[model samples]
Target: MQTYPVDIDPEQLIRWLEAKHAASPSVFRITAVRATDERMVPPRGTHLDDLDREDLREIATIATLEIAPAHASEGWLLTVVVEDEVGPRLPDKGALIEDEQTIDLVTFDQEFIRTGRGNASVVAAVEGPEAEKRMARLLHSIEADRHNSGPAKSTD
Candidate 1:
């Protein structure tokens, strides 16, 4: 696996994933951004852009990890939410991330500033096919809006 700088720009991260998709046809991207509402109340779908400002803030702190397995059946994307909430059912039903994993968060909290690798890893993880599709869809929507806008005319 190739290694990249940890402190990566979000846009750069997306481009990297796009490259990965081009190279590997089977690999899929899974994005795990932070959750804004402790309640986990998102619009209820795969649309990452639907994530609100609060959700983005929460995602900024935690690394959004994505993994794509070689086998299609085995491939599944998830958003890992790092917090104190641990139990059978999460604290809030609205929170979509219903699972948790034990990771050395020292890197996410204390060491990212010094090493910069923690956040970069998070961005790297999301570079997969699924992620590319979602990103493309969102971009298409934005482009459609711009195209639909009427041409500008002189005020004079």
Candidate 2:
């Protein structure tokens, strides 16, 4: 139940996630790719590496978490797209794509207000051992990144 501040480094977040899949033979069961700010605009094919930290901080973000289970050689490829938005809404989850094979979808909007002095809320639908391990790694990476980035500056 650790808490992550609302103002996280978007670029670092994406890099950490990408690193999970870049390991030898890829240790991650799920791979997450993120596009923040104006980089999410246009044809939507902008490379994550092409965007800098400042650009990431100034625009909206869309992160796609792609999962691959460990059983079948080609397991179902489910994609979870997380989009940033403003305003009010209770956190929840719903099906974006459901079928016999793939179950691609988006979770409820995990809001992070700039003025709010609190942690961002996340809702994960996936479960089981692999999923748990993946989540733990992601969380650990985030915490480490935050700490290494130094203290948070006053946005007021």
Candidate 3:
């Protein structure tokens, strides 16, 4: 499997994840902050300009995917920390936050690349008989999305 670099778009990743796993009761949270902002800076010798644009942007993103299986006592959590340059463009004090019930379908083609075991481990982490079905569906959806020409359709 290909390993996607940390520069992948957080929104796109979130969308792909949502597209494949929407049936399950899952929540995806994506937060982006400026790396050089006063709140994010350290008091040490490091200067904000010291870091390259890519690094600076990448250091700004915080993302988490949580899955709760139906009738299950416990759920699974998958978190990814990466960088992106898109945050600076967002309004609302250089931070963009998204919390929604359904995944917003926007074009995410080329935003993420297939990598690792995919999110199978995350699905497996859910404890219930439905885990296997969910896992299979997620895997298949991911594969289909990977080869598709455009972004996954938005359910909006």
Q: Where does candidate 3 have its weakest 10-residue lDDT segment?
A: 115-124
Model 3's alpha-carbon lDDT is 0.35
Q: What is the lDDT of residue 17 in candidate 3?
A: 61
How would the candidate models be sorted by lDDT, starting from the highest? 2, 1, 3
Q: Name the 10 consecutive residues with the lowest summed lDDT in model 1.
A: 147-156
Model 3, residue 91: distance off in Å is 22
> Between candidates 2 and 3, which one is better according to TM-score?
2
From the highest TM-score down, the ranking of the candidates is 2, 3, 1
Which regions in candidate 1 have their CA more than 4 angstroms from the true location? 1-5, 28-34, 38-65, 68-156
TM-score of 3: 0.28
Per-model CA lDDT versus the true structure? 0.37, 0.39, 0.35
CA RMSD, predictions in order: 18.8, 17.5, 11.2
lDDT of 1: 0.37
Clashing pairs in 1: 6-120, 29-128, 29-129, 32-79, 34-59, 40-94, 40-95
lDDT of 1 by residue, 1-156 (tens): 222233434333444444444555344534343432334444445355643523442222344445444443432332222333221222443545434433332333333333443334322223456644543443343334332233211121
Put down candidate 3 lDDT per residue, 1-156, tens digits, no spaces.
Answer: 112223334445455665544543233332222222212333255444644332433223222243333324323223343233233322345564443222222212122223321121121343344543444443455545652333223121
Best by lDDT: 2
Best by TM-score: 2
* TM-scores, each model vs. reference: 0.25, 0.29, 0.28
RMSD score of candidate 1 (Å): 18.8
